[model samples]
Target: MGFLGAPVVGVDELVDRIDPRPVLESRTIHEGYVFDLVSETADLGEAGTVRREFLRHPGAVAILALDDEERLVVVQQYRHPVGAFDWEIPAGLLDVAGEPPQLAAARELGEEADLRAEQWDVLVDYWTTPGGNDEAIRVFLARGLSPVPEAERHEREDEELGMPTVWATLDNVQEAVLSGRLHNPSTCIGVLAACAARDRGWATLRPADAPWPEHPRRR
Candidate 1:
């Protein structure tokens, strides 16, 4: 049978069957504060061989924090790469060794948004750009939020020092996203996923510390 003029197929039939190419050689080309550039040669079996360069990222987390008013907590910060002030969810790099992604998310929420959540759940996971980078991100849904104690607040540094945090309605965020005013990948993914989760009564959300075998930091 066909649906939408396309032949239907079982989910199992859509699984990738090709084996991953074997890496022939790999070397670090540059090391930066956040990630490293690496060049690699791989044997692609029937496709012959190829050499590619990509970033070796340390992974990161984004938090979609919703407060009692159902407003999203977001941060407006300057991203040097894009040379623009981006409206993004509370996020940070997973540079801390051995720190769980959830903990990292919580820490970023506190530091960037100055809020703490008593409830958290895994919303989504995505690769920022698998074609050229190994950067993976986990988006989390946080609720039951309260301001972090002043004494325990984290001081911002560098680009984060002057960044401003705000709370916005989901409708306004969706408009910004659709209008291309907000282009941050994490923010886009987090907001869209949060919207879907909310529509479904958040039944799709996983536990805050859900097992993430695919996250490199966890492995």
Candidate 2:
């Protein structure tokens, strides 16, 4: 629809799409524990072929846990690349082959926060860095929170060790995001999306098992 005298663009064209180009040349430059750096040349038909380098990721999942009082659970963990202990939603990589994303999210929630949820919904999905990396992350909204049994909790290691968790109101988190305080992509997108979904009576939420066609593994 047009707005404020602006031209209306087709809604169908607004979505990101798969425009597969013929790969002219490709090679892995570096192999890392988490992701691989790859360089490739693609034939863009009339636009000509071009080469690019990016990190090929296996995708990931994040959980935005909310309690009955509508407080969100956020975790603080040191990110070496950024050199800061950033606040983020419970999240982890999709490293296990053949595991479902929702299950992965549940696992992250338990492992990172020592919590579990009785209900789950797809909050949002996004690419962390489309220009330089192929990392896609699916965020899930988790409700009906409870602590995991002490005997069954996963041990934290490295950056995860000594991590602290906090429960904040959704509005406060949203403000933090808008004010450029919270920089984690999953946490920012997840909280803002949760607010939007809640405003719409959660009618916009998708099933936890919703198809994620954009995931590189799925492709």
Local error of candidate 2 at 172, Å? 1.0
Highest lDDT among the candidates is held by which one? 2
Question: What is the C-alpha lDDT profile of model 2 across 157-193, one tens digit per residue?
Answer: 9999989989999999999999998999899999999
Per-residue lDDT, model 2, residue 13, is 67
Candidate 1 stretches greater than 4 Å from native: 1-7, 10-20, 217-219
lDDT agreement with native, every candidate:
0.87, 0.93
lDDT of 1: 0.87
Please name the candidate that would achieve the greatest TM-score relative to the true structure: 2
lDDT of 2: 0.93
On a 0 to 100 scale, what is the lDDT of residue 153 in model 1? 94
- The local lDDT score (0 to 100) that residue 125 gets in candidate 2 is 88
- Please give each candidate's TM-score: 0.90, 0.95
